[model samples]
Target: MLSEKSMELSRKIIILIYGRAFSFILSLIIPLVLTRLLVKDDYGSYQQLIMIYAIVQAILLFGMPQSLLYYFPRKEISDRSLLIKQTWSILAISGLLVITLFGITSQTMESIFPDHHLQPFIFLLGIYIGIMLSVMPLQNLLILEDKETTAMWSMICFTVIDIIILPSAAWYNPTTLGMVHGIILTSIIKFVIVIFYIYKNYLSKLETRESYYQEQLAYGIPVGLTAMIYVININIDKYMVGLFFSSSVFAVYYLGSLWAPMFGWITQSASQVVIPRMSKAHNNNDLLQIRELYANSVEKLAFIFLPATVLLALIAKPLILTLFTDNYEDTVPIFSIYLLLLPTYALNLGWILMASGQTKFLLRLAMFMSIINIILSYGFLTTLEGDNRLLGIPFATVAVTWISTIVVMYKSLNTLESTLSESYHWKKMVTIGAISALSAIPIIALLSLELENKIFLISSIVIYGITFLFTSFKFNILNDNEINLVKSFLPFKN
Candidate 1:
């Protein structure tokens, strides 16, 4: 299984698995720690600022680095120097443009949204943008060259920095501003490490690859634009929520929305490997291999995500109650609602569109959905805001995701054989999930009775996991390859 091609892909997948799992652990732990150390308003304020930070970082990326990832792997090592230079040039220009725009609208940007505490918001988020620009080149190299160890280590450095800074900074006055400063320092340290690696390992011996640069830009721009618009389309609600509702309400929704990326992150890292592999499959004109890969991806996705959806549905209240303070319990329903879309993420056919050069159609679909999403979220969140309508955002979010999934499925089916059993595997997974979900509810109800949070969460997770495993095994939903794929990642296998 670990041939040159398979070996490279497998190593990258392992790296991505490590990265995704560690990042998820970091997110869960950091928020839990900070939630304890900080006041509700302070944590809420910090969450709001990160929302803006996410969009700004997206701007710095501007879809350029990903383009670099696609074409970089195709070029010769001799031309790498020029490729590195041109890629940086593109990033530099885009970064400057983003900074310039920020400079002009800094005050408006800060005042435009009062979701967070007003003091030094621009500086706080500026650090995030800088981190994005400074990290992108290294990130590209990691994916294209399949340097998992280096990439994971680089991220580990930042996670360690964050772990140290959070508690220490809390002792040093623990304000939202202090939290921001700690984050900035961590990003700076990480950016330095990434730059050192890129220069020593990649940039120092770089040869020019201008032709590939242009090709990359052409392929990457549309996808990046699609991503940018998709970002707005997806989270435009958070941006607009501040306009229409209270910062505190946005805070509740924000806490709920934090659950959004957990499943997406898992799928995303897998897609990083799968996209390049699938692209190679296309290049080789291996239809059989390509079809098998797609089907296997779906199966693996269901294996991972089906349980998440069921678990989240069963235990959002306990999970939040245990991990966060009492202030966040109200947002529990939003997490439950968000879990409804977990499968869409694990069923990651959309990445196929972006990676396979169908980004324009994807972009169009994104724009149409964004408009619909913004409308639904604004329409609903406005009505529900003060009256405990926190569920509105997730409802709208799930709607958009399911719609996008359906559209993508249709498009993907068009690319396959007419007699293909594309829906059969999906149907089986859903059927098994329905049974798993049903069995989990009694446990969920029992756990809900205790409200003590931690114990209930632990018990719920254990029962739900065992139940899911039994159901999956019984239904034959997991074939040999999928089971083996999972076993390879676990710590110890029988």
Candidate 2:
């Protein structure tokens, strides 16, 4: 039975990863094509629109999704339907607040942009905010409920729709608003599908009541606050950038941020399932399952993040060139600095902190993190005028970010010992890190030889990646289950 459970867990993890890979590929293709098709100014407006959407999304969900992700995974969900209804109630309240604030601030936002009357567009976006609020937490339920195949396939199918429709919209009339229209239309379609799936597959049978709503609110609010704080920590940098930098420079920073920070999604996806899975694992007083989950999550990321960040730093030029037209030179160095976050974020999840049932404390700790990020960003963007100095702002901010996260994580690690193994996985990870770094020697050599074109850079990257994977898997550095999880995707490996 234990073997079967492990197998099931492993299988689910693989399916989720594969689904994300498919979605990610299509995601890349659409963005890459659109970036090429749209001019810098058009792309800049589109990106700004996205930033506005992100902020709106954050507030619209009323942080209910974070609460859902936190508690829904537990085996002790005595009244699932009631909890779900309560979450929806919270969402309703929060969504209204966000829209109201947007109303008051709409004109000021347009003034800041200096080129667009964001009010109409923000209003268009406001209508869907409630729908979006449901979808994200519903996604949380799908993953927690182990509806992997449904969720995975659904996302891929949506991306396929996006891939076809978005570029078509651009081709017919490649204006900035046209592109935005295409994206919204596509997202609305996906949202409809998700709502349908969530109800049909999971939420339909749950009972709803007032008591459960109150109980979940009592528990979920702290988790939601933690989520908001974490978001504040991460998004605050971008917010500061928009304030202090030129619109053009803000555009460059936005584009460069496209890759490195979102790479943390690798961690996010695994932890999305991991949190619920770990929460369900009988870690009440025992540490084995918790340790297994934490160590495995951390270790898997080491292989992913270390080289990617280093290589991203090396390949920023080609990446930006390949993804965007060569209208901008600022993204490369700025992205190189931003790429430093790859390793730091990969190592610890806010979920690990969640799994230990320290939501309030984590929220407190996140306050410190947000404080640090704000102060550093202010220093770089304003006090020191680092944004004007090209990559200097990102560089300074990245340094501060890494230091702060490391200090906080190390402090958090001791508490996680209940969930993480006593083993020195970090040490083993370092050894693998060494091997991965060694594999990159060739790429460094190529760089020195001034092989600057896209092909050489991309080819060198492929070589280094293969070399690193070979080194890690050939020895016992990655055990059978870890290797098999990766292999499950490959036709031959199966």
Candidate 3:
């Protein structure tokens, strides 16, 4: 039998997974609808504006929202309200500042991307960012307060609204500007909902403490800096592609670089649930529990993500052509290159470091990776010529990302006073990878048959899924506890 704490953790993870799975399905519909409704150049411009919004939002939040997971588990019940209020105030101010910054920089951006005419959309992006940043902590607060079910429902509702509104707006006006307007409207709805929820649950008996502000900032700023660098590192490839290519070409590259929403949904949900538990273990100075948590999380992620990487890489060509149409056939190679990142998804080394209060280490590591990525990207881009050069961007990104993952893993193990053999299930992960690769032989054979793209794609996926799952089970890839946990979530009782 599982302990109460273990059962609680499992329950939270399951709730989050269901919510994210629904959100992922809704998110996929957006690209399918938008790609058909808008021209390539217009789509590219919209993506560019969204990219800017992402960078600004990540930078501006300054990690205060993330800090909540670390601090809340350690705080007294009476003191938690003050912390929430302080964090919200900081984010609200940052939101206003973002709006002002966008207003000031709109003309400059217009000059930079003269063809895209992005200037008109900048202010709306600013508004969306401002409102979004204010409500960013809603999920964190809900999870910490033991309201995982509420958090899951909140996410589902938001994604449903986004799916309905965004494509409808684009269909009505069919322009990048129309899409921005749609996004702003959705953000407004989300903002109202989040604010009301927070006030009703957390602000009724508000407390204030001037010193809490400094304490949160001290913890958050390094995290914020690390987040900024990390975003830049991942997005550097897209930025390079946008700068060097036409909007239409950039749109193709963007589509290729798009990671499956399912990847993030799984990794992020796992991290969110694990981080709070790890923080508590750290607070109690229980290194053994921390090591067990870290190892188990990585192992479980590998079981899913490793096989996923193999299967996705095998299906990349058909998947890309079918999703975006043949106009983006060139994207197949870039998409394949990005599949290289999926295996690394299993390693959430940063979560361990964050739980241990190694924020500055994360910042420095992020900076190092950013600098390496820039150099590698520039070298690849300038060294090659023509369309082939675009491939270099993903190549460089994958290389540097792996390098950073290894370094972080080393530091994380050190913090736990554990070695790689003790802290990571290397043998089990190796077995999983081997099984996944062997299972793909049939997929390769299926790919050679002459059939319609849709039929072939569906058939190949079915074959691969069955082969992989059967082989994994035969090999005992998942332990009894993990299997039981999964079975518990099934509708039918054993």
Candidate 4:
């Protein structure tokens, strides 16, 4: 039986997962529609612009939104409102700064990508980033306030509108600049809604506190810096491809390295639910509970992501062709290589550290990983030739990611005053890995048949899923309680 706290945590995770899943589906639809609607070059340009936004947003917002999850849980109810206002003010100012920075840097960017004529689109991206940064805390705010359902619905509505507007804008104009315009419009709408919601529900009176501002900055800055470097590390491969290759070639690389958002959705949703509880445990000086929480989160994530990693890698060919069409068939190998990072996703290395308030360690780790990633990517690209060089980028990324995961795990165990075997469910993880690998044997045989792309893909997935589930149960990888919990969620459970 689950404890009350455990049940509550599970409920929150489910709500967040539902929200992210809906948003992820809509997000996938945008690329699917746009890839068919726009040329490869235009699509590549759009991805580059988005990459810029991701890097800048991660840097500028400085992890203040994340700070909410940590601080809000620890603060008094009276002080929480002031904290929200201060965080929002900081984000709004950062948003303006982003716009100014873009104004200054757009010309330089245009010079670098002379063929793409990126100056105009860079300016639009600045505005979009500004609006989004200001509203970034809305979801976290809702979750903190016990409004998870509202938060879930809000995300669905926002993504629904985004899917409708973004593709329609691209359809109408069919250019990279047109897509930026659509994104800016969507950001503005989201910005307005978030402001209104925050004011109406949480901000009756305007309060100012320099101390509160200072405290949040103290916490958020390190997290933000870590996130900024981490984002750069993960995306360095894409940047390398974009800078060295033409837009068409970059498009192929982007498609091949495109991470399925489902991995992020699962990890992030779990983190959002678990972080506050872990913080409370930390506050109580409950090291045992903290380890339990951390281990359980990783174990549950492995149960899903481990098998998913194998299944996706197996179906990479037909999956890419089916989603982005045969035009992106070149992406298959790159996609498989990138999928190597999925197992690392099960680790959730940063959350435990963040909950434990080891922000500086996180920052140092990010810096080290970023430096390694850049050096390896440059080395691989320079050392290899032709498409092999393009392939090297993902290889470098996967290598650095696993290294970081191991380093972080070591640090996390040290912080908890525990051993690796004690802090992690390594035995269970090994079992899950074995089961996923075994399930792939049948999938490998299916591929030998060389059936039609779609037919073979569908059959392989269904067959793999059934085999994995059966083996998981037979091996007692899933307890009876977990099985019942899963069945309870099924529509026909009765």
Native-structure RMSD, model 2: 3.6
Sort all candidates by lDDT, best to worst.
3, 4, 1, 2
Error of 3 at 490 (Å): 4.9
Q: Against the hidden reference, what TM-scores do the models get? A: 0.87, 0.86, 0.95, 0.95
Q: Candidate 4: misplaced stretches above 4 Å?
A: 107-116, 205-211, 260-262, 487-494
Each model's backbone clash number = 5, 3, 0, 0
* Whole-model lDDT values for every prediction: 0.68, 0.66, 0.85, 0.84
Q: How close is candidate 4 to the true structure, as a TM-score?
A: 0.95
Can you write out model 1's per-residue Cα lDDT over 159-215, one digit (the tens) per residue?
667788876776586678878787777777767776677678767877544355567
Candidate 4 residues 1-494, lDDT tens each? 55656655766777777778878877889989999999988998999988888888887888887898899899888777788788888998999998888877787767786555577787778989999998777888888887777888888999998899999999999999889989989999999999998788668865654456777898899988888888898889999998898999888888787774336878888887788888888999999998988888888888988999989988888888989988888888898998988888888468878998889989998899899999999999999998899899899989999999899888888878999788788888999999999999988998889888899888998999999889998988876767555554343110
Indicate the residue-level lDDT of 429 in model 4.
92
lDDT of 2 by residue, 109-144 (tens): 677765553444665455445445655675566776
Give the TM-score (vs. native) of candidate 3: 0.95
Instruction: Compose the digit string of candidate 3's lDDT tens values, residues 1-494.
Output: 45666755776787787888878877889999999999998999999988887778887998987899899999899888888788888999999999898877776777787554677888788989999998778888888887777788888899999999999999999999899999999999999998887788678888665546877888898998898887788789999988888899989988888874237778778778888889999999999999988887888788888888988888888888888899999999988898888888887458889998889999999999999999999999999988769999999989998999899888998899999899988998999999989999998888778678898889888998888888887887755666677676554221
